[model samples]
Target chain A: MANSNTQADFRTRLQDWIPKLVLSPSLAAMLVFVYGFIAFTVYLSFTGSKMLPKYDWIGFENYARLWGLSHWWTAITNLGIFAFLYITICTIIGLGLAIFLDQKIRGEGMLRPIYLYPMALSFIVTGTAWKWIMDPGIGIENTMHLWGWESFEFGWIKDRDMAIYTVVIAAVWQTSGFVMAMFLAGLRGIDNEILKAAQIDGASNWNLYRRIVIPLLRPAFLSAFVILSHLAVKSYDLIIALTGGGPGRATELPATFMYSYTFTRNSMGIGAASAVIMLMTIAAIMTPYLYAELKEKA
Target chain B: MSVATQDTAVSTGRVTRTFIYLLLILFALFYLMPLFVMVANSLKPLPEITGGNMMALPQDWTIEPWLQAWSSAQIGVEPTGLKPYFLNSVLMVVPAVAISTVLGALNGYVLTKWRFRGDSILFGLMLFSCFIPFQIVLIPMAMILGKLGLAGSIPGLVLVHVVYGVGFTTLYYRNYYAAFPTELVRAAMIDGAGFFRIFWRIMLPVSGPITVVSVIWQFTNIWNDFLFGASFGGQSQPMTVALNNLVQSSTGVKEYNVHFAGAILAALPTLLVYIVAGRYFVRGLMAGSVKG
Candidate 1:
């Protein structure tokens, strides 16, 4: 009896320990890899690391150099344009598509995939395909000429001033459908009786959508903005494949700038600084969004 | 009041409906243009392409570009095409997806059913990882990978993705498991089923929906990733990197058809996933945004 009691006590302890054991790997990994790396990057930003990691402390010099660079200025401005246009255009197209589909159209399954398929692809693939379509010699411009519209010219990929807009076009193409899906979900989730009530009240379609439908899609709109803004700030592969951040740095974003400085230009310190700035920018967008998310869960 | 006004309103409604269909078709066309161009151009030879005809069916049907993109296209000094990089992406994605999914399941089981103190704060921190730009961790991650002697390797890329991707995966599973009935778990425990036993037998058997969500989500993300693939995959770059290199290789002559083929080839897996399990794909995306 004594031996069996000791064995049962041991089993209870093991049961209690199992959850922690399963949970520890992920917790330790997050602490070390996520939080610990974040701290390490902050420290590196203050150091004079160049072409390699260095421990020599030189505080704020890298930040000063980073802010002073013209290329960094270009990246920041391009981000403003890209983020604004990407978020706004995707929202408009997505919202419009969602509303149109909400009208109970036929062949919805077929049409939904057509819009959603692009979001399934990698940006590199999107960029490469778009680059081909936007190529001056063999792309849309040439096709337009072949179609007898010789006045048409769509060479934004090769044009310095208009290159960023090309990035915007490709991004919107890839993600607007995703935004559409979100809005559609939100629209579907809405109570159908409200829409019916509006109809019975003799509200016109235009006023009905604007007053009730659009306002109720607020959560979808917020998600769309947050997701689009996040994608814009982190965009790198698309720029690399489409413009490589140029026709002379016209579409340079902080994400791309961080890469070139760290790996290509051999300036780790400034690269870290740029990364920190990008994090801060994302954090500004993310904190409240996260708060809302957690609060809702709570 | 009865006839003229009603006729006018009905005619206006018909016109508005026609306008709506036309607008939707036009938008769909715009959404599909690049993909159409890619497929159309990939099937045609260089001559048909350079003749300034993009939207037309191939006058000269050729699979040479597809073959070339798969086997002969140059990426850097190697003319060995995207095959190796495609394999590398598969290699990285499989392990990362499997590992992250399993870990997420464990984390979810613990966070919900086991519920120790401070688990929400721990999860909140993990949730924050999902929003962070990979740029912030690039430098330190590079160092850590080097210290572990996995830098620039496929495994290094896998480690990076798994560590970062676990956050999203955990969110998926946690939200899912939170809704799971605790009665079954308690019953299993009373029957002397241990943690792993209950998870493996009872919980996992019923996790089909969230598993689909988790696996498909991780697969697409790890497969489609470029920044980590570019930054860390080095000589063992993923398909996206190889595709970019193939498109921009700038050899003696530019091969537009080959670029189209390569791009389509690179996108095919995720495209197939969306096709086969599209409902689950949408569910995952919706769940990601709403729950996360």
Candidate 2:
């Protein structure tokens, strides 16, 4: 009887541990892959690691050099422009389309997917299509010339000054539809009674949106801002495919900068430093939003 | 007075509605222009695209570009076309998706059903991993892959994707399973169902919707990933990298039609998924961005 009782207790204890055992693999992977790798990269940034990772500590030297490089400055400046325009234009176009579609329109199901199919595509595919369309010799400009508008010019893809804007245009085209969907979901979630009450109180359609609707979409807006900003910081494949960070380093963002430095230029320390700065930038934006979101749920 | 106001509002609304429809259609056309251009150009002969008007329909339609892009286009000195790389993508994506999704489902099951101390904090740590710029991990990941003898190979790429992708799949499953009633799990336990048994018999049986969302999300992302493919895919590059090579290769004359055909081929799988399961796709997108 005592032996049987002890066996039953052991089984029960084993059952209790099965869940944790099941979860341990993923936890271990995350610890080593995510946090451990991050720690390794952070450590590499402070060392004199070049061509390959070395152990000699060089303390802030890489970061100071990174900040001093004109290429790095250009990359940062281009990101500021790209992110600003991409965010603003996407918000405007997205909010407008969402509002317009929200009004009891016909053929919404058909139209919503059209706005969104681009998001399903690879950025490389997007870059390829846009690169062809934006080419000065054979694309829109050529087509316009064939249509007897001989003076029409759309060579932004090849232009040094305007190359970054081309990136913005492609990014916007790919992502704005997603932003619209988020807003539409938010718009749908708003209580109809609130809108009805506002209408009865003599709120015009314009005022109704500007006051009640837009304000209520604060969460969606915040989500869009955070998601887009982070995406902007991490923009790599798109720029590589579209511009190749080219026309003489005109369109380089930090992502491409980091890649070139680490792999091509033999400056792993500087590349790691640049990558760390990029992380800090994203964290600065994400930390607060995630905190509030997780805290509220908790 | 109310009737008069209602009449005026309806009349103005009709005009505004017309304007709104016009704008929506125009925007739709704008959004669709690139797809149209790609399809039309891919069907046209090379000379037609370069010499003739781009907006015009093909004077002589041809499937030569598609055949070439599929079978014989030069992607970095190999005239092997996109077939091998497409296969590489398939092999990489399937296992990566399967492993990540299974691990995520188990992780979600534990976090929600088998609640323990400091679970939320652990969950938070995993959640934040999803948002970090992957550049931070690139150098170390490359080193690690090299150390493990998996560098520049499909398995290496798969492992990389799985590591980054698990965070997302976990988020999806955890949020989904949270709303699932724990009472079912509890009852199963009382009935002598083991942890795996309850998960398999009870939890998974009802996990169809979230599974679809998770699978579709993982499929699209892994299929479309370029950074990892470019960084780690040396000899066995995926379709996107192959396509980039085919387009950017400057040795020969720019074959726009071939490039278009290749681009379309790269896009077809995800496009088909979007067309078929777009509702779930949107849900996944929303769920990913807006935290529960």
User: Residue B29: error of model 1 in Å?
Assistant: 1.3
Candidate 1 stretches with Cα past 4 Å from truth are: B1-12, B283-292
Docking class of 2: medium
Complex DockQ, candidate 2:
0.55
What is candidate 2's lDDT per residue for A1-298, written digit by digit as tens?
9999999899999988988998888889899999999999999999999999998999999999999999999999999999999999999999999998887677998999999999999999999999988899888999999999988999998999999999998999999998999898888777776777787888887888899989999998999999899999999999988989998999999999999999999999999999999999998998898788778777
Candidates' chain B TM-scores in the order shown: 0.91, 0.93
DockQ values of all predictions: 0.52, 0.55
**lDDT of model number 1:** 0.87
Residues B1-292, model 1: lDDT tens digits:
2232223221236677778778888888988888888998899888888775888989888999999999998888999988998999888889999999999999988988888888888889998998899999998888888889998898899899999999988888888887788898999899999999999998898778888888888899989999998878887899998998888887778889998999999999999988899897567555543431
In model 2, which regions exceed 4 Å deviation? B1-12, B283-292
Error of 2 at B155 (Å): 1.2
Residue B123 local lDDT, model 1:
85
